[model samples]
Target: MEKGIKAFQCVEWVSKRKVPHTIDIVDPDPSWPTTFTQLATGIRAALPATVIHAVHHVGSTCVPGLAAKPVIDIDLIVADPADEASYVSALEAAGYHFLFREPPWYEHRLFALYAPPVFVNLHVYGPGELDLESARHRLLCDWLRKCPADRDLYARVKRESSERAKANGEGVGEYTEYKGATIREILARAAADAAAAGQGREETVEAGRAETAEAGTGIE
Candidate 1:
């Protein structure tokens, strides 16, 4: 099948389902890391050798002790994300469903897995496309894992945002907006820390990006 057609089918399939946005955060699950490892193993086995540039455990769940919705956000860095023909079929065969194709967003393609025991947002990015966001993801996870103060602040903000969204009868959009400003502030601080250490600053995560929330409700 053509990629465009497959993407359309995926969208239609999602529309027919009743997936809902997460309304609350939970304590960091000890099993999340293992889940990510298993998912990455499956993905690695499915891709061609040349396409497996890197696999990353990103998003809120990656940071130990950080409260998050129970979903794994993974970045599968490939040599050419635009070359869907080479990888998509194999991914499908491995039980991942291609739910999104965003050429404008650094040529990102998203796959989703909704089987028992695991839920994952598999994001594929080409070389240099996610350099900034990728750096932000890694550093933020590292910083939060080591710095208790920042981690507490982030968790508090997340709780407040969840409350606001629930009260406002809004979905992920409201939750994301209420959380974005705080996240940016944290990222700025992280960048400053990097600069002071003479490690240089990572670029903002939103630059040259196009993200869609319709794929699923998890905040990845």
Candidate 2:
């Protein structure tokens, strides 16, 4: 499904929990995609077919050979993220804990699974609600997967960011912020490449606008 363009907004977390945590960057695992597939299958089974619009494996973990934080990031496109009652309970039942919601930011909802099987960040967005952020996520993943140079560059930035965050006693948010500049640089290249190929112009424009507003906000 195609998403329309929208302005970026940094909405405060509905249920904010400010906690210091370790930012552990690990080598790429071959099993990450398999894990995402398993999780996606489970999510599909847990929710009604009519409720789910699309399921995507996004974030750094989706990029092969890219060093990441060992947490799987999944984008779950639904009919309406604001209508939580339709899908939240089922996700909770499936062992994903409801973390928070950002109604102003594309009606985004976040769910997490921090337990045994595997850790996952399940991001929910409504159709036409994920304009820029969604486009950026997909572009980044595809670019990194095919472009080894950018993939390596991102890996180095991630490691540096993790080290700096750890040294300063910062959490995931700060760590993510540290990598913003490099992320934008990489995305710009990806967008340029797409434009040259005469494809994904809409996605490139939307994603570029998103980076201009807030680079690396939703990345990883």
Estimate TM-scores for all models: 0.81, 0.87
Every candidate's lDDT = 0.68, 0.75
- Which residue pairs in model 2 clash with each other? none
Cα error of candidate 1 at position 179, Å: 0.4
Listed per candidate, the RMSD to the true structure in angstroms reads 5.7, 3.7
What's the CA error at residue 182 for candidate 2, in Å?
0.4
Weakest ten-residue segment in model 2 by summed lDDT: 1-10
- Best lDDT goes to which candidate? 2
For model 2, how does the per-residue alpha-carbon lDDT over 43-128 read when each residue is reduced to its tens digit? Answer: 99999999999998998888888888877888899998878889999998998877777666667777887744347878888776
